[model samples]
Target: MAELQEFIDDRPDAREVRKALAVKLVYQGYKYEEIQTILDVSLGSITSWKQAYEEDGISGLRLNHKGKKSYLTAQQREEVLSWLQTKECWELGELEYKLAFEYDVTYESKRSYYDLFDAAGISWKKTTSLNPKADEDAVAAKKKEIETLLARHRQEIEEGKLRVLLLDECHLMWGDLSGYVWGKTDQEIAVRVVNIRDKQTYYGAVDYLEGSLLLKAYNAGNSENTIDYLRYLLDQSPQSKITSFFGDGASYHRSHLVQNFLGEVNQDLSQEEWKIHCVRFAPNCPSQNPIEDIWLQAKTWVRRFCALIPSFSHLKWMFEWFIRHTTFDFATLQMYGAFSEIKY
Candidate 1:
């Protein structure tokens, strides 16, 4: 059942109506003791009346005091209500401006304004949805799993002659976007994008632990592209020296083309000197792979400088900017939701 308001003596004549006299006495600039002395009222009576005056506004001052100077004239209240009517959101600072300009009176301070506001019962509020359940336990489990995987992988890296690399991809937009911004306002600083439709995207390959860029390209990250990139690196190097590569579970990375390419590399290379291996990322767990971390760094670099690039002709080349000038030489990579590396 819904709650109903309790009975109140809202009529012009009642205990509350009588209480208004003391309220008016106090509001008219009489101190509690002065009101008590002049009106033959007790100090407690003065206190209750003042409380009601502050809480209920003008109606609370209708106690029929014969003659009392008004602390705040009737006009002052109308002005406050008028100001409130014109604005959608209220800031006390804005109200202070009017007080100082019209009356040459400054609210003592923020504390003073708030103290008065409490009795007025004007509370600030925000809108939010009450979400049910939490995933703290699931998150903790993921953290533990990633930590364990990284430890095991590091041990394999040191114990065996396995060259471990992480693979991933990133989508790069052509121009400025306000999905991120500075300062707190819903207003967006419009930024122009080069090509709003076809935008752009990039694929990357990197060392899992060591900060190194194995390969990069601005193209569809399919199995063919992955194979082609590995072949390009093999052609550039003195020998196809990379042994083990770890990649997130993208369809292209998991396709037969990439598998065949790795198998062929293993067959062609000297068995004693080199052999290629692959590590598939666990389902829905891109953070388990180190390249995911590298991709985030790549995005940070692109976001900060993408506007400087002269034309879309070299949009894909922006990622290499991070490789050359980013503070990655002695970077430490962290594994959690996704692999991430930071210089600090």
Candidate 2:
């Protein structure tokens, strides 16, 4: 420990002297945060410096003191870039290992490796979720069918005789309250979870013409709840004679219980004149329903204020409040050619 101060005093290079000083601070029982403020270095760098000094003594604190030089020839750099482009994703350690083994090079700073990634046109990004079972042809055909239906009801919709609602269900868990936020690097941001698996079921519908949202919280998403939600939508739009629902192919949506309720509601009316009509999108293709995006927006809104939520009931209240109050103007609402070919 005493030798670290002597090394810091004797080192000619300012960079090496700084590394030695950080190591000496750690030996003197200084916290990483305090050392960071004192040295203006990151906690990660302080940790690495302490580990390096413990493993290799004073020699480890010296920057590029050994035979190693952080350099690669132009051709070698191009080769590394080519190797990076061969894969869709990578870990930083993989690049470090490749440079150490193949090119016999190592950079003193991680920024150099990041520069290589930039040169290779690679970036850190979040991955999107896609269902492998989705059929493109089926999705296209369903979209076309929906477009034709909307066109046929264009006059009725404009006259307030028919209300087209894109419907979907959301199962939000308490764990969803946890999301990314900027905080100190040395500390972790955590949301206290009483029951991580505690779930809330929500039925959301977006009015096609008005772009207004309707949301209802239910105990569960079963056939009974499905029928009740449909009734709820009807009660909300009493002005519209016909209420049409576009939703996913959930089992409860097509169950006999819901069908029986629909039968009772539209007993005398013809299929075209039915008071309540339900249309299912392509199986496993959630992207076909614009209400899915509305649900996402609602969840994102609640997650933004997750820290203030004290209980799951409060979370549910916030989630429902955001959905019911917000008017959606998302472009996805017009994906089925709404407001263009099929005018309001």
Candidate 3:
């Protein structure tokens, strides 16, 4: 029933829509004879359509003129596949146009075009951006440093005397809630955004040993908020004697105000015995911090239910709720050689 509704809303060809509507009516307890009378189709056609849909799903309802036989010869198919591989990207209509104009052959079903794409080793994928300024050597050195640091404190961490936290900040905006979703191709899909620039700052830390998460929201990620967030981390782990934070080299993280706060907290202890410690990842290499992935997952969680989020406040609440409630066991967390370098 849901498939039928999606197909109907997508506004495919009139014939396919008619078949899907007929099937939907049948599922809604309409008799085959009633469906025939309403849709002006024969009883046999309605029964066959219903049977085909049950057996093959949406693909069953697809129209094929050659009765399940290939429309293009094997040689022609090879030519099409070769032509498709010549481009990095394509649209469905381009393939259709190519077949129609060059070979005078056209398949009524879009699946045929997709099948051709599959045969040519093409699949739909999202592109990711690369940081041009990231230094490979610096990232490797930082990873090694973090591994050694974690190894030095492995005994304390195992005994629950020390807590390791990977920290990062997320600047979420109303525009961030907008992402890819399946919808009607003929109609424009839009999220109602009162102000795209309206933003919220979030500080998140994921426990390296326990997989627990700590999240806090603030007006901005300045020195003041950074200090408070550090205090919040300390407050959460009162039983632990030491808390170590690994994060990016944001200016506020190393600001004098934040440094002064840390100094006050560990004034009586030596550097090794300080209650709180902070380490910076290599510059411009966010991939080194697993907390970056946590932030991304939180935003993705909120975006999945963006339709139900009534306002920016609600969006922020939903984002925080997911982070605080979920236990993160990301594979990237193990990429820093913690498991091999540090004995549990």
lDDT of 3 by residue, 1-344 (tens): 88889988886688888878888999999987688678766454565567778888887776652222327888999999999989898976677667765776655345677789999999988877668899999999988888888788778877777888888888999988998788897688778889989999888888887777888889998889888899999999898765555566689888899889988999999977888888778887788888888888888888998777789889888888888789888898777555422445
CA lDDT of every candidate: 0.53, 0.81, 0.79
- lDDT for model 3, please: 0.79
lDDT (Cα, 0-100) at 261 in candidate 1: 77
Pick by TM-score: 1 or 3, better one = 3
What lDDT would candidate 1 get against the real structure?
Answer: 0.53
Candidate order by TM-score, decreasing, is 2, 3, 1
Please give, for residues 191-260, the per-residue lDDT of candidate 1 as tens digits. Answer: 5555655455565556544556665555576778777777755554443345444453467777888878
Please give the range of 10 consecutive residues that has the lowest summed lDDT in model 2: 335-344
How much RMSD separates candidate 3 from the native structure? 11.8
TM-scores, all models, native as reference: 0.47, 0.77, 0.66
Strongest candidate by lDDT: 2
Look at candidate 2 and give me any clashing residue pairs: none
